[model samples]
Target: MEASEPLSGTCHCGSVAFEVSRPAFMVACNCSICRRYAALWVHAPPASARIVEGEGQTDTYIWGDEQIEFHSCKSCRAVTHWTGVDGARWAVNMRMVDPADLEGLPVRHFDGADSWEFLD
Candidate 1:
């Protein structure tokens, strides 16, 4: 996909949907919860990512420091995106995106499990 193209994705059951600009890079976190969810996060400004559908059809989860809220599709239990509690930051689960759309994106591995540093 073109760098300027938008990346759109939906939950497994299509209950939630979103669109974000092609991110400069994606993050693969190895933290406990992140590893379980297998989420590939792509961060963007709050205004840069848009929740296009199922605004009220998701369940939210907050743990640890509760600094972020993770939203998932209620129907399919698919993690979709996360937003900072402070509301200034946001990210989408790029795993929901088509593999074809993410062909050439750089992925950084984050060691959130311990030192909380990027492994790569």
Candidate 2:
């Protein structure tokens, strides 16, 4: 769970697996979709994350402007991560990450619904 340690996570059914460098912090967004899912997000470069398994066992959902595509595990229906349509940016669902790996990391609130800005 140290900052230097890498992070690996999977969906409830293990149909989706991925890894990211330990995040220094994460965001809790209040947008409608995020609020519904209650997802905590950890940002990472698209290249920094790799799908270790279940590439074909996942489903994508893109709505609104469709700038980002949310990915979930088809088997367990767990929201695992999302990526920009352009493949430029990405975010992992912190809920799927190990609790031990999130210790000491700040969770900032984001006003994604009204202002699309960080609240603190």
Candidate 3:
């Protein structure tokens, strides 16, 4: 996908929908929750993302420090996106986006399970 274009995404059941500018790359985090969900995180400013639908049909999961809230579709139980409680950052689950939309984006590994650093 082109960086200047927007990538649209939705939950498995189409309950949660959103759009984000195509990112140059995405992060593969090894944190517990992320590891389980296998989410490819595309981080961006909160304002850069928009929840186009299903606002009330989603549920949030906040763990540990509660710094970020993970949102999932209540009907499909698919983790769609997450956002910082302070409204600073937003992370979309690239797994929820169409494969064609992520054509050439590289996946960077992050050691969230250990030092919370990029592993390469």
Candidate 4:
């Protein structure tokens, strides 16, 4: 992909799709839910991310403090992203993005399971 092109992603079955400008880095969290989902998150300003397909077609899962809502593909059950309850923030699952686009991408480990800090 060209540097000017946005990073695009889709669920396993292509039911949900979105695109966003390449993020500075991605996050790998160790929180309970994140550990199970195994998603690599690319945080972005809410308005910068575009859900080009399957808007309102996802199944939402909210747990714990419920500060965020996880959106997944209703058909393929692929976790796509999470959004802040107040809509101020959002993140896309880079796991759903094309692997080629993720080459050399920096992944920061987050200690969401405990200290809630970046581990490195």
| Candidate 2: clashing pairs of residues | none
Candidate 3 residue spans exceeding 4 A from truth:
1-3
TM-score, candidate 2, is 0.92
Candidate 3 lDDT tens digits, 6-107: 889899899899888877689999999899999998888632668898887878999989999999999999998988999888888889889987888899
Scored by CA lDDT, what does every candidate get?
Answer: 0.89, 0.85, 0.87, 0.90
**Candidate 1 regions with alpha-carbon error over 4 angstroms:** none
Models ranked on lDDT: 4, 1, 3, 2
Model 1's alpha-carbon lDDT is 0.89
Error of 1 at 81 (Å): 0.4
The regions of model 2 sitting more than 4 angstroms off are: none
lDDT of 2 at 94: 81
TM-score of candidate 4 on Cα atoms, chains taken together: 0.95
Separate clash counts for every candidate:
0, 0, 0, 0
lDDT of 2 at 68: 96
Better of 1 and 2 by lDDT: 1
- Looking at model 2, which ten-residue stretch has the lowest summed lDDT? 42-51
lDDT of 4 by residue, 9-120 (tens): 9999998999988877889999999999999998877326788999898999999999999999999999999989988889999999989888987999999999999998
The per-prediction CA RMSD against the true structure, in angstroms, equals: 1.6, 1.6, 1.7, 1.4
